[model samples]
Target: MRYLPIDNQLFVQNRQRLAPLLKSKSLVVVNANDIMPTNADGTMVFRQNNDLFYLTGVDQEETRLVLFPEHPDPKFREVLFLRETSELIEIWEGHKLTKAEAEQVTGIPQKQIYWTHQFEQIFGQMVFEAEFIYLNTNEHTRAGVEVQTRDARYIDAFRQKYPLHHLERLAPLMHYLRAIKQPQELPLIQTAIDITDKMFRRLLGFIKPGVWEYEIEAEMMHEFLRNRSRGAAYTPIIASGANACVLHYIDNSQQCQDGDVILLDIGAEYANYNADMTRSIPVNGRFTARQRAVYDAVLRVMKEATQMLRPGNLWDEYHREVGKVMESELIGLGLLDRTEVANQDPDAPLYKKYFMHGTSHFLGLDVHDVGNKYRRMEPGMVFTVEPGIYIREEKLGIRLENNVLITESGNIDLMANIPLEADEIEEMMN
Candidate 1:
């Protein structure tokens, strides 16, 4: 791994907390993500399964984590099955983890090194002993199909082998635990944000009338790589002008124009933790008065929404409150009439016509990080406060986002150093 090692205590505590949630005599299993293939001999870069990484801190492929808290043998309680490295693999792909190394990295004392071929025999032995199995799967609402994942294949095979055992979904428990960032995870996310801030500042001088959108993406990548990040946390949306209206716009091919605004929703990933940041700024040195009005309104709504992210606040209620805040901002921007809002459908508000997406989501491991929307805010919970107004007809989209960590007092803005105010942004650009 290019990134520095994360403290194993984070993973240890994560497993400790989750162990009680499992049924007695049950074993919890987590598999690393498949090193997905493209065409021919080509393959996409490997991304470790967030759940597997969360539990074991093992970032390699063909690795499996078995947590049998109720095992008769203490060594079997938490076993890490790794891809036993061979001389050939070392010559080609460099060294894979040794048993001692995996133990050190994960702080799980018991390690059973195995090849991919031995998985069935080893796993089958555990299945016969356990009454229930906690199988990990991607249950995130935003997850969409593209290719078959390792977890998906594991489920199909596991059911065929042990159809009688009660299979429980591990995603819900993982979503709950991973959503709440541990103290050790916070610094890694902060490092990502710091790198992202540096990249954004670099773009201020680099972005101008003639720069292509992809060039901006390249600039951010340069900064990320230099700062020890894997790269952009997600596909960067370097949308300029009308393209900003497309929420997931990532073509990044168009040339930025003088009067146009570029919506940049990008962040760097340090360790496995991520930072999701969005900033819309003028291509020129300054925002037009009209643009400034809408930008500031979105900024105001973002600031207010962040304040509501303290402990005990429900995620759904917080979003509803954010909608009202956005409704007011839209009304202030003349996009909504006060009377219209009063008469609008409760299910589909007038504000949706202009400001479409939700104001925030849990931010951490994944960009749209893992958290139940139904879950109440806790002090350790981290989220993104991103509220925007996109008017395709007007060819304008303004979004300002920052990472906020819930605290005892209220919440701390992790991206507090990143320039957000219109004056600060413009001054940085100039």
Candidate 2:
């Protein structure tokens, strides 16, 4: 792992929280993500499944965690299975976790840890004792994964092996638990945001009228690596000028022009926790009057949305309020007529022409972290407040984003120290 080790207490506490939510005699299973293959004899980088990591603090492949809180035997109540290592395998792929190492890393009892090959026999004995089987899967509302996951394969195998066993979805339970950050998780996220802040400061001094968009991307990668981040939390959007108006623009092939603005949507990933941030800067280190105006408007919306990410706030209602705020700003910018806005189809707000996306989304383990949108915001929940104004006709787009943490009293902006104001960014660039 590129990131530092996280305390196993966090996972212990997470399992404790989940145990009570499960029905009696239920056995929860979480599998590590498969190491995906690319082309001939090539494989993509391995990323441990977030849910598996959350439950066991084991960031390795071919691993499984089973939680049977009501098991007749204490050892089987919480067991971890690891891939058995061989001399040839060790030489080929470095060290796999030893039984003792797994116990130390995951807080699992060493005696309870067994090799992956023994799972069939051990799990067979445990499954018959449990009345219900809970299996994990990617249930993110926006997820569109085409490839089957290790968990999916396990689900198929279990169904065929025990056709009469009552199976249950574990995603909702996981989403509910992972949505709120634990005390230990906050520092990891803060570290990611801190790394991104340093990179942005460095980037300000490097951006010039002639620099290629890819050059800026290179700078971002360099900073992230040195700071121990595992690159960007998601694919970065390094869009310049008209490219910025294409919401998810990632083709950073164009050259920056003196008067054009570049929209940077990037963040660093640390220890599986993530940061999500966005900023729009002038190529020549000075925004045009129009650019500054649009930038300020988006900043205003971002700030307002950040404040709304507090306890008791519903996700759907919060976005609706942010839309109204954007509508007011668009009218002031002469992009929307007040009469036209008021008369526009309530189903489709007129402000969407300039600001089409939601003002905020849950942020943490994943860039778009998992949480029940309908559930009210609570303390320890982190969110990304991003508001943008895209004007394709004028070849301009302005977006401002920050990570926010909802606390008992109010909320804290994780990226507050990072440059956000147009004047501050301009000053730093100059």
TM per prediction: 0.97, 0.99
Question: Candidate 1, residues 1-430: lDDT per residue as tens digits?
Answer: 8888878898889899999988899998889998877999999999999898888899999999888888877767887788878899999999898888887789987445555667777766676789989988788899897777888898898888778989999999899888888889899889999999999999988999999999999999999999999898998999999999999898999999999999999999988788899999999988999999999999899989989989998988988899999999888888889998999899998899888889888888898898888777889988899999999888999999999999999999999999899999899888
Clashes of 1: 0
lDDT of 2: 0.92
User: How many residue pairs clash in all the candidates, one count each?
Assistant: 0, 0
RMSD per prediction, one decimal?
1.4, 0.8
Q: Can you write out model 2's per-residue Cα lDDT over 1-430, one digit (the tens) per residue?
A: 7788788898888999999999989999999999999999999999989999988888899999999999998989998999999999999999999999898888888999999999988888788899999998899999998999899999999889899989999999989999999999999999999999999999999999999999999999999999998799989999999999999988889999999999999999999889999999999999988999899888888878888888998999999999999999999898999999979998899998899998888888899999999999999999999999999899999898899999999999999999989999999999
- Per-residue lDDT value at 354 in model 1: 84
Model 1 residue runs over 4 Å out of place are 110-112
